[model samples]
Target: MPRAILHLLPLLMLACALPAQARTMSAKIARVTTPVATLEGVEVRLDWPADAATGELRLRAARVDAPDLGYRFRALEWRCPLARDGQGGWRCDGELHADGGKPFRLSIALATGSTDAALSQGKASLALHRSAATPDDTILDLTRVPFAWAQALSAQAWSDGRLTAGTLDGRLAVRTPEQRPLRVDGTLVLADGGLETPDGSIAAAQLGGRFHIDYRKPAGSTLLSLDGELRGGQFLYGTTYVVLPGRPLPFALDAIGRDGQGWMLPSIQWRDGAALQAQGSVAFAPDASLQDVDIDLRSHDLSALGARYLSGWLGIAGLPDLEASGALDARVRLAGGGLSSVDARLHDVAIDAPGKGLAFTGLDGDLRLSGGAPVDSELRWRSGALQGITFGAATLPWRSADGTLRARAPVSVSMLGGQVRFDDLVVQPPAGGNGLRIGFGLALQGLQLGELSQTLGGPAFRGTLDGSIPAARYADDRLDFDGGLSMQVFDGSVDVTALSMERPFGVAPTLSADFALHGLDLMAITEVFDFGSISGRLDGRIDGLRLVDWSPETFDAELHTEPRRGVRQRISQRAVQNISSVGDASFVGSLQARLIGLFDDFGYARIGISCRLSNQVCVMGGLRNPDGNRAGGGFTIVEGAGIPRLDVVGFNRNVDWPTLVERLAAVGSGDVKPVFE
Candidate 1:
């Protein structure tokens, strides 16, 4: 609109040359051209009665196009009464309409040496001024103007962005000279501004800022520089979401680019006092993907850092509720769209993830990583916890290079009345289409089992726990421990083998292992479980055990008395009754059922039970009869060996696993009662 009005200045000057005797004049031009714009089908008319003091003027154009500015208009018309000012100038005021859009007021004042024009609609207005003293310079003043008015200008640089809402108020100086590039420099205030790309990957809203912008177009290339303070707003780019504080943040950027060639940022800076400070440079590909980046960041108040700058990334990484505190400084560099190097310094940092059972405190370190050169660093943490198990301080010496991180020294932490040590730990971060990979050697020494049980809320069995994992590797969300872990408890050794876990930190974690118990003291085991007293040595094996989400799924297990020389094998009446109730067995003895109530205990030659569990059912088995034959299609659970001895047999072979578990739980809670019959 302003361009159309400016082009009429020359025509208006020619009107001043008309003879005073001339009553009317008209002219038509097929096309008129200017450096920035072109007009077609232009017509001008003026009428003045010889006695009148002013002339009536009309201007019309079929189309106006400014390709460089992305502006096009059709059917533009304006009519106004032109009068000479007392100071040797001309003034015209009239209504202007274009492209069947709303009509607006266009006022032009032409002086002998200067020209000024204004286009106003309702509460918004834009005014332009140019002087003969500086023919190449034009000054524009804007008041409550919609940002959409500059959509064409914005498209010249950011073709994928659409300005959805905003308002601008400020002054700008535009320079257009025949021998120089076009330039626009200005200070502007923006309010309630919004812009977004078609894919919604880049978006901002409610943005308010005061900025100084300088933009230049040199032939086929463009350059821009901006310095400003953003008051408050939210914006998202790719996976990064930033929520600005209420206090202003000072920032600056300089960029250069050409059409379809993407952009290169030479410098960028941001300062938010102690909360954050950042300086960086970036490059984007033609498709708007990141090509390279180098940034340095520092934060003195890490308590506010997560919410302000880390929430979006953390949420995407599956730790939405993570919290952190303390100070940090870091530098990162990327080349060819991949990480090339990183350096981080931490001071007294603490991180916690509630409900996930992982936390760390008092962390201090400097870690440096490079894909080319080796870097040495050390990290120390005062305390940490995993799955409710807390561990004391530890320090790790690290060397990172060639995309692998290796521990230079063994790491040891005291926990559960003992110490755990890791040797030869190596880590490879996710890259090249693979997940994280870690390999380490683990050793446990003199850990108290009773304390561990108490901490884990399990049965109170007393002894020492020790194990050595010669090799343990984690990859693809699964962890495998080679070699076995052994526990000394109940005067026996329990060994676990083939231990592996899948999705250890993900949904529905699973564990599978096999266990073997040798020569365990039944008396102590029964006392720990609060089951009826049993006196003998026991042996057991649980093979192919599987658990999902910490719940038992399937297993093949067997427990039996081991006949050690000089060992008394006796089963109390209560123990016998509890076993009968759990296994759905019946007693068979020489004495009558009534007489069985009188005995306080019974002697057993042997006792054994086996269960192969699958699909929520337990297939029960017991010791074979004397002749290695079935006794009335039943299995003997116990064989008598003394006077008034008793035997127990199980008739039911297939028992619901849950029901069996309920019966065992009842026995443990002392809710099951002995039945005489």
Candidate 2:
């Protein structure tokens, strides 16, 4: 109902008191102004007939503007029969239409001390009451009203949010005191509420809640405080996705807004029984980016944490299916959208990544890190495993400050019948223009390779592994070791240099290194690999070796028996046959084929084989000629030294890497047959 009609009711009442007769009255005003709205081109008409107890009223307004509320309406018209009530009050009911929009029933009741008005469309309605004694206040009663009706008010605060769907049923009180800020207080019941921001970074759906809200705007600033119980909902903020439970969860927030500087949330609280409890303060920039935040969180039941609260972050961290169980309390602080500090206490926690061969159990710690002043902390875990290698209990002491975290002392963990020591460790977390980086020194002492081989499903190798990496660093998802690792196995030493890995925790982890084997007893190596027995001192080098997903992708390798004063160079008949089969080679000998089988073993002056692998292909080579070059026509795999000697030669120079691997595997399994030529 237009206020113009209400103001003219008194004149109508006075006219009704006259003698019964056919009469008409009209009034035209160029403009009318009120505290809340301005009307232009207002017209009012009244018609009375002697036979009628009521008068016909018509009111029209060319335009109505309420700039403060962001509401503007054009071409508003209403017609109704005006009548007097028994108590000297007035009532009118009519269809109100505005700007070619839907027509709703507009009913207004005016009494000596109070006024009531209602606008209804379909099943939705908004009713208002104002008492003359309290002119500054208005009470609104909503019934199944579309949430969109509040868009004008919402725009005053959240200019970027669009209410897409939902309905409200609640009561609200609006107060506008003279020379004071406007205030609104309400208790609202929301159902299926949905809202979204333009950038798709913040959105909510199926949000259902009952909330009490206090909102005020004073000149240039806005303030809002709300406390509510959310029944269920799903919301996304940047990479954080939150899914409210079906059971009610208590939530509260208080915030202040500046005209062009966005919002400053002074308080936020949430409680989910036995699962999570959190309190935080956050500030956002004009562009809605997080500027500062401080939060404290506790979880008594971590089993539910991953799916309910951690999925979005874990997915982005490349551990989407990570699992955990235990109790934890943590506080985190951020400044300028980067981490400032973190303090966490864990109790009997267990974390696991299925199918990744990484897990930890019985973790207990109070870990603290700071970006400003120094902070010290310690973490201890009972057991952990990486790539199937289990390690025993260990404690790590740390100090953090100035955006860097460093180990306070060397830490050692029992692993594979020995210990792995880490020293001089320093870590820098991801910050401006940089990713996470870690530097450490690693030393392996008296580790048993036999146990390692068993866990890795490799050959039953027997040795004590000892190695030192004086310097190692990890950054940009890659780990590089400046020094080398050495293992004492097969009565010899194997040194690995230029060791590095990429995507260590991500898809298809890759590793590259160079290996040098010296003075390894062939008999021990053959027995371990289940290759045919041989007696010699073997030396080899594998350079540019690369593996992807733990499978060799490329390498340049050469293995040979080097003569020594006290070492006898002999190849068993089975060894010769297996070598020939694996190399796709043939035996050339003076002895007949039938007679060659008679000898159990043969002497070899020199034996060598080489393969340069690339692009899934292996380019094969063998012992060099006397001129220090590859032999032409064919390559000698084994050069004979004694009478009735056997020489092995390979004709093919290229082989599919996978096929060669299969051949080697067949020899190890005793599934290969020799062809003598």
Best by lDDT: 1
How many residue pairs clash per model? 0, 0
Candidate 2 weakest ten by summed lDDT: 1-10
- Model 2 misplaced stretches (Cα beyond 4 Å): 1-135, 141-152, 164-167, 335-340, 580-583, 588-596, 624-636, 640-643, 651-654, 675-677
lDDT (10s digit) by residue, model 1, range 1-677: 55544665666666655664568988888888765678889888888889888888888889888766667889988888988887888888899988988898888898988999998888889898989999888899999888877888888888888888888899999888887887889999988888889999998988889999999988888899999999888888987898988777899999998778899998999998888999999988777777788999999988888888888877644466788889999998877776688899999999997756789999999887777789999989999988678999999999999878899999999988899999999998766667679999999998898888877788977899899999999998899999999998889999999999987766677999999999999999888988888899988899999999888899999988889999899988889889899999888754636667888888888988899999999999887446322567678888777878788888899999999999999999999887765
Clashing pairs in 2: none
Evaluate residue 24 in candidate 1 and report its C-alpha lDDT on the 0 to 100 scale.
Answer: 94
Write out the backbone clash pairs for model 1: none
Give one digit per residue, the lDDT tens place, for model 2 in 1-677.
32222333333344435444557877778877654567788877778777787887777879877655556778888778877776867777898878888887888777778878887889998888889899888888989988887777777678888888889999988787888887889999999998899999989999999999999878789999999999898899878888888888999999999999899999999999878999999999988888899999999999889888888877755577789999999998999887899999999999997767789999999988898999999999999998799999999898999778899999999999999999999999878857789999999999999999999998888798998999999998899999899999989999999999998877888999999999999989888887777888989999999999889999999998899898898888889889888888877754636666888888889888999999999998888766223355578898877877778888788989899999988987889776667
| Model 1 score (lDDT) | 0.86
Error of 1 at 597 (Å): 5.1
lDDT of each: 0.86, 0.84
Candidate 1 is scored at a TM of: 0.78
> What is the TM-score of each predicted model, taking all chains together?
0.78, 0.83
C-alpha root-mean-square deviation, each candidate:
5.4, 4.9
